[model samples]
Target: MKVVKVNLAKNVAKVDIGGTQQWIRLDIVNEVPKIGDYVIVHAGFAIYRLDEKEAQETLSLFEEMLRHEAPLH
Candidate 1:
């Protein structure tokens, strides 16, 4: 997931997950993330931050899975 925005007041961050945007709570994360940072979100919360390489790798894997599992048209 990519951090798009952060709501410090609410302790929630808006993230882009596989092109979809959603708000995730930051209470579970040890480190605060800024916009453009990649994070690992689970159960409506960010668990950890990902480096650029890891982020790209994860995104690629997701894209691959989507491409293979998408419904045939």
Candidate 2:
């Protein structure tokens, strides 16, 4: 996910998740993320920042897995 904006007072950030926007807490990350940074979000929190290579790899993996999965009715 890419960070779009941050709310320091709330300790949360607004991020783009595959084009969709969502808010995630920043408390879990080791370092604060600036806008345009890529992060790994889990359970409503930004767990860690991802380097460019790792981000691409992770995104590709997710796309591949999702493509083969059965869709919900």
Candidate 3:
């Protein structure tokens, strides 16, 4: 997912999960994240930040997996 917005005062961030907008807590992450940064989220918390190249590759893999699975549903 990609961080699209950050509310430092509130320790919250809005991230883009695929095409969906999700709000996650920034307090749990080791470092603060900024907009346009990719992050790893779990249980409504941003757990880690990811580099752009890695994030895009991961997203690509997920898209490929979904494409392969789409015919089943």
Candidate 4:
């Protein structure tokens, strides 16, 4: 999902999809990602924070997917 906002003090993030908003907590076990950085979120947890290269790759993949079809889950 797309990371819309990051709350560092709470270690949580606000993600949005199709106008639906959700809060995703960051895993304390993983390195804390900075604001504006994107991570792979699952359920309520941020499983893995993406590095620069990975984030770019992921964004590209997302764009490709969006180009193919409407976002439906």
Q: Pick the candidate with the highest TM-score.
A: 3
Mark the 10 consecutive residues where model 2 has the least summed lDDT: 49-58
Q: Tens digit of lDDT per residue, candidate 3, span 26-52?
A: 877877888999998999999998889
The global Cα lDDT (0 to 1) of model 2 is 0.90
Off by over 4 Å in 4: 1-4, 16-21, 65-73
Candidate 4 has an lDDT of 0.75
CA lDDT for candidate 3: 0.89
Candidate 2 on 32-61: residue-level lDDT in tens?
988988899899999999876888899999
Number of clashes in model 4?
0
- Per-candidate TM-score against the hidden true structure: 0.79, 0.82, 0.84, 0.59
Provide the lowest-lDDT 10-residue window in model 1.
Answer: 64-73
Q: Look at candidate 4 and give me any clashing residue pairs.
A: none
User: Model 1 residue 6 lDDT?
Assistant: 93
| Model 1 Cα lDDT, one tens digit per residue, 20-54 | 99999999896999999999988999999888798
What's the distance in Å from true for residue 54, model 3? 1.0
lDDT of 2 at 13: 94
lDDT of model 1 at position 61: 95
